[model samples]
Target: MSSSDHPNISGSSQPLLHQKGKEIQEFGTVNQVPLGLSYDARLYACQRLNRVLADTRMLYSLYKKHHWLMRGATFYQLHLLLDKHADEQLALVDVLAERVQALGGVAVGDPRHVAELTSIPRPPDGVEEVPAMLSRLLSAHEAILIDARDAAARVAALGDDGTNDLLVSQVVRTGETQVWFLAEHLVDTPLVRL
Candidate 1:
């Protein structure tokens, strides 16, 4: 190796690797952000938003799962619907995470962490009956809608309109629409009346 081989290289240039450091910002804490929100408001919004983010991720995973395992006469329709819902949930996941970051708080990103924080129950490993799978989805959506409605109201009371709008406009509305779709699938309507 010649010294002139690399013009910008200093003697013994090695990349810094395997670096470890203490946590800069712990979970459940917020930084000092001048976004016109008080500390309590920011912290409260972060806490609520992170919970919703976790559940949204879980719901996305569930949608993917059910979509893959979907079977029967409605399989074709369900496969597409579940996938569409999953994509929307994934988008919400990003939006929720960014909202948390914007509030100067850490967004829960790890699957393991999300599993811990999510209120949604885990479905069985094996496929359930199609009705059961749809029921599970409806249940998850209901859980999220319940929390979202409460959180939206509380955050609005705290004077955090952005978070309130996100919870109500995006989370609550999407959840309600999806639940309506899923619930209809369980209806005992005859395609051809006798």
Candidate 2:
């Protein structure tokens, strides 16, 4: 006649905790959380790693699309530029994915997930014009590199040794290189300034 009479709540139907325990036993225990840091630190590292991985994917796709569609103004140079940019981005994808796995989180592979999670903006529609495409591409890559640096700093500050090491030794260096390459294109160079 009372709520206590309910089997589910009163343990008559086996407590929810017990049921969950049984289910976990049947499914096998989940991965153990890594030690050596506060929960806040670990959570911060995971989120930072996720941010970098998603941004890597978004930037890679933009480079590839722009490579194929780019036209006008220094056509050969821009063509080669986009292609090389795509290659650089492709290399970063592997590093970011590995970092995500090392941190105990799944790397985002689905384009939908990348789009949903990435802070970077999508390339504007029908942006086949070369200078315009180059401008957008530069901005996108710069934004991505900045996020990578920020995430690296966050992970380092949280004392995630592995992520910090990876970030310092490779990720940040490559990102800076790519950013430099993209930025250099925008500088005005005189044909005859001698």
Candidate 3:
């Protein structure tokens, strides 16, 4: 067949791969936006949201790990609960990332970048006892909740209502509910009275 008959198969063109270039937008800088928010407000909100986004990613990781590692008497229930919670956290990650972008800042995309930004402590590589694992999740939730509270207040003060609403209405509320669920699993209660 003539090369012109199958242009796609011609040896003249190849796919672009392994391309690298300088970053167009630097991290920690916000572009001017016309969302009725001042540049400073947008900048501050993006900074706070990115920090929470990083921690939420870590929390999501913890939930997945614990969900898979759930064992002992309440394994089935705890496993299902952790997986559900993980899914919720995943949803929050997307929402949080988009919020940062809406503020005209770069959302931290790389897992390595998230690791560098997250304040949540790294857990052991091995599986922990069931209660210990549950406790670890609660601790992660606590960290996120604390940050959410502070960030929400600061963003509100900065006149970034959208960011404030997201931190309070979504981040804080979700973390608090998840914490309640995880904490209940650690209580010394039997499935039924002996």
Mark the regions of model 1 whose C-alpha exceeds 4 Å error after superposition: 1-17
Best by lDDT: 1
lDDT of each: 0.94, 0.70, 0.91
What are the per-residue Cα lDDT tens digits for candidate 2 across 33-97? 66666666665666676677778777778887887786667767877877887787788788777
The global Cα lDDT (0 to 1) of model 2 is 0.70
Tell me, by TM-score, which candidate is best: 1
What ranking of all candidate models by lDDT puts the best one first?
A: 1, 3, 2
Candidate 2 off by > 4 Å: 1-30, 33-40
* lDDT by residue for model 3 (80-162), tens: 99999999999999999999998899999999999999999999999999989988899889999999999999989988889
User: Superposing every Cα of model 1 onto the true structure, what RMSD results?
Assistant: 2.6
* TM-score of each candidate structure, all chains considered together: 0.92, 0.74, 0.91
RMSD of each: 2.6, 10.6, 2.9
Better of 2 and 3 by TM-score: 3
